[model samples]
Target: MSVETVGIIGIAALFALMAFRTPVAFAMLLVGFFGTWILGGFRSSGAVLITETYGAVSNYSLVVVPMFILLGNIASAAGFSRSLYDAAYAWVGGFRGGLASASVIGCAAFSAVSGSSVATAVTIGKVALPEMKRLGYSASLSTGSIAAGGTLGFLIPPSTGFALYAVLTEESIGRLFMAGILPGILMMGLFMAAISIVTWLDPKAGPHGDHVRFLQKLKLLGKAAPLLAVMVLSIGGIYVGAFTPVEASGIGAALVILIALAMRALTLSAFYEALLDTVKTTAMLFTIVIGANVLNPFLAMTHIPETLGTALTTLGLGPYGSLAVIILAYVALGMFLDGLSMLVVTIPIVFPIIKAAGFDPIWFGVVAVIVIEMGMITPPVGLNVFVVKGVAEDVPMSAIFRGVMPFLMAMIIGLLLIIAFPQIALLIPNSMFG
Candidate 1:
């Protein structure tokens, strides 16, 4: 069989396994091992796998993954999420559809600390869902907002997605983080706008409440100051070259723990749980990453990406046409795969095509992350939707999915905005790192 044919078969088998509910890491590993064995002799394939595994795990840049995850886990357990929610609620809860708006704002703030989308969803969902329900907000609006808003976790700094993308594509993590800020802010604004339009069209979707005094709001903001400061210092420190990503994570983690201790929110039990969760999450991410290391090289050996790039170039589609097709492919895949798995599986193939198309790697990373974020809230296997469902069990799954539709539309608009004006993502990175 041709190398291209083998590559196609390998991809088909991977998807079949995934459809059968095989773990993504294992699915990739299995396909990679067998595919490499077919392409090269088993002895050679085995040696290559071992070498790739070691290289992936031992790389210094990959260290940022665990450190960032640890920082997020610590912040999650340290009551930082609660403070963030309270601050947003106090400021916005009096406006029409204010509770839903608060959830979006709160999720953005929480994103500053927690880089995992599902973690952000569950943390904010648990804290905000019940209150929104009690205030008579529709289930769709409440659950949908949290699910969609949770995607910001990766769009902001300290993003695990950004970290992983940096390691994979050899981009600067600091610049990638900085590049995300404007796009992230724009996305948050889009969500807020969606909430406003929804509530305005149908007032019952969100009801206003008694306003908090200015002093009261000020007090609530004070509660969130520690989190705000940590975010600014960690993100700012990285941008200004004051610290590396790993060092910034360490500082952020330490500050979060101190804040927890100061608030009396950290007990021995909570601390232990934070450590345990971090270990678990980190182990899972690394497992998939290592598997991708083996699979990516195997895929490369097939010459599929190069072949596709050549074909596209011949077809006269140029860069933008090829990019549109790639984005569409992501949207279709997003329906089935989680964002991380989708990225790990496809980026090795798609990224070279993107680079060959004359796109900047860092700029592509931001756009790719946004596409993955859309998948997180999209249906069938939307991780964020399931997370909100876990929190608001009484609400129908369909309603939650329905609620996220507008935000999903907003995300689509956001993606177009980023694509149309690459500078929206590139400006910060260029200014800061140039």
Candidate 2:
């Protein structure tokens, strides 16, 4: 049988595994190992597995994943996430839909540390949902805001999405992290604007929050300052070349733990739990990396990516047209696949087309991350939506999906603007790197 035909079957088997609720890492591993054996015999498959496993686990760059995740887990245990939400609420809660807006802002801040969309959604949703419910906010608006806002975790600096993308594409993680800053801020603004539009259309949806005295606002901001400062120094340090991504992650994790202890917000048991959670999360991500590495070699042997790229070029679509098709494909994939899975499965096939078309790789990274973030809220597999549902238990799942619709539109708009003027993503990375 032809190699390409075998590759197609492997792809189908991978999906079948996923449909059965198999973990993504194992699914990829199973498909790649058996498929490689089919094409190259047992010895080659064994070597691929052993070598890829060691490479993924021992890669020094992966250390950032554990450190950044620990930083976030510890921050949550320390109650710093609450301080961020309170500070945001103190400033914006008086406006219509202000509480919801604050939720988005708080998610962005926490995302700077956490870099995991589900974590951002859960942490902020737990804090903001109760307050919005108590204050008579509409369930759709309140729940939708947290769900949409959590997507920022995948876009902001220290993002595991970017980290994994960098590892797969061999692009600069620091550059990708830098590239995301402006777009992340822009997305947060768009989410807030969507809240304002919702509240304006139906004032009953979101009542104005109580006015806070300036002194009280200042007090809450002070309480949030420690984590806020950590975010700035870590990200800013990257921009100025003060440290490598790994260094920033390590330092940031250390700073957060120290600050949490200083505030007496973290008990020893909580600290231990954070460490355990970090280890588990890190192990899961590493397994995915190893699986991708194994599968990638099998894919190359089958010539699927080369064949697909050639077919795309044959379509007579200009670069922009080809890009639109790719973007649409990503949207379709996002509905089913998680961001990391999409990145790992598709980048080898797609990145070459994007590069051959003369598009900037770093800009494409931002665009890809944004599209994956969109998937986090899109239906069927809207991971963030389900997370928000877990927190706001009484709210129907349908309400949360309906609420995220406007923010999803905002994402489309933001994505178009970035595509039109690539500089929005490129400006910071260019200025800093050049």
User: Largest lDDT belongs to which candidate?
Assistant: 2
lDDT value for model 2: 0.93
What ranges in model 1 sit over 4 Å off?
Answer: none
Q: Each candidate: RMSD to true structure?
A: 1.1, 0.9
Candidate 2 segments whose C-alpha is farther than 4 A from its true place: none
Candidate 1 yields a Cα-based lDDT of 0.89
In candidate 2, what are the lDDT values of residues 106-224, reduced to their tens digit?
Answer: 99999999999999999999999999999999999999999999999999989999999888888899999999999999999999989999999999999999899999999999999
Model 1, span 1-434: residue lDDT tens = 89999999999999999999998988988999899999987986898789988987887877767777777777778777888889999999999999888999998988887788988888988999989988999999999999999999978887889888987778888899899899999999999999999999999999995589999999999988988999999998988889988889888888888888888877898889888988899889888888888898789889999998998899999899999989999999999999999988889989999999999999999989999999998889899998888899899999999999999999999999999999999998899878
Least well predicted 10-residue stretch by lDDT in candidate 2: 304-313
lDDT of all predictions, in order shown? 0.89, 0.93
Q: Give me the displacement of residue 82 in model 1, in angstroms.
A: 0.8
Instruction: Report the number of clashing residue pairs per model.
Output: 0, 0
